[model samples]
Target: MKNNIGNQSDYDERQIAARGQAFQLAYFALLGALLLYACSEGLFGRWCDAGAAAGLCACPSVTVFAVTCIWRDAYRRPNERPAGMIALMGFLAVVNLALGIVRICEGDVVQEGILTFFICNTAVGVMAAVILAAYLLRLLVLRKEREEE
Candidate 1:
């Protein structure tokens, strides 16, 4: 039988290089965020629950990776259209934000002077929104460049 795995060689050299750099940067960002989280917790005390802490550590690296890929024009496959992805990100942002707001209104986002797991919904929403915004901004800049050229 033929190999069932993907070709894995579809990405061109530039895309591969860009992705490598993005991964490196994202890794550094994740390390820094985790270090900060640990230091903050050790110094000031627990400011957020585990879920929120995880979001705090994860969001920055994800954003860095996505933004880097977007700027490098490597966020999508060469044949892919971004409209569907844009719509999906928008939907995720809206849903998470709505849920987060509901949780806040219900007084479920914080307890005993520390943020609870419910706050992670807001963090996830914010991260998605930020990535969406970056992607849109990159698209706009590319459009402008194309128009000028």
Candidate 2:
């Protein structure tokens, strides 16, 4: 009976560890995808009409990348993520939230020209906000559950 109980405990620990690892992997994957999207838009371009629009579109992607990378690093190696990273993520999250609100507020401008452009960008920002929030929530829940064990 003692051996069986010990084996079961060992199995449970392994399962928890695996879960933690899987969460980190998923966080990194999300960060990578967001970074790819940011790069495709040429982030450092001159601020012209198209460039400004592209920059706006890229904001959420950058935010997603920043947050997810911080989260992944923090999860994989607890207490290893630098304070700067946490600060950066917090800053980016606030900026993105403001930008998303601005986009929604200005949505009426879509009727003027290139309706698809406005629609697509707005949709992207909204989706990014939703996804980022969901990811953060999942991370918090997982972390809490891990701690309780």
Candidate 3:
């Protein structure tokens, strides 16, 4: 009887964790694909190969690990906040924006198969930045209200 009563809360926590994992995987897939596209032999220059490889393989792997760790930390330690996850998202947005600009400056972004996908990356970056900005604004407003109170 006691176990059954507590099962609902446990079930809900499992659901939230499951959703977070799914979101993490989806984010990885999207960023991985874009990095692969950018690294395509004929699309970008030789200088970009190392950077692209780092982004495609190393970066995503590290990011996923970091996020999973943060999530687990929160799960295991209730008082711990999700500030790391928020920082990760903002960092990713900045990385995307930087990659987009690097591609554009390379002079090959508008050429051949790179044009459409490069634009897509830029657009995604812009969207991410907008979301980050919204989060920042909300945080600032809430802080101000707390101070006023």
Per-residue CA lDDT of candidate 3, range 33-62, in tens?
666756664575543344434444444444
lDDT of each: 0.89, 0.50, 0.54
The C-alpha local distance difference test score for the whole of candidate 3 amounts to 0.54
Off by over 4 Å in 1: 1-9
Give lDDT tens digits, candidate 2, residues 42-117. Answer: 7754222453455544555554543454344332333333345345445655665566567658773244333323
lDDT at 115, model 1:
87
Relative to the true structure, candidate 1 reaches a TM of 0.89
TM-score against native, each model: 0.89, 0.34, 0.42
How do the residues 13-107 of candidate 1 rate in per-residue lDDT, one tens digit apiece?
Answer: 68889999999999999999999999999999988888888887998999899889999988877667889889988998999999999999999
Model 2 alpha-carbon drift over 4 Å, by segment: 1-79, 82-90, 103-113, 116-128
Residue pairs with colliding backbones in model 2 are: none
Q: Provide the lDDT at 125 for model 1.
A: 91
Q: Ten-residue segment with the worst summed lDDT in candidate 2?
A: 73-82
Regions of model 3 farther than 4 Å from truth: 1-82, 112-114
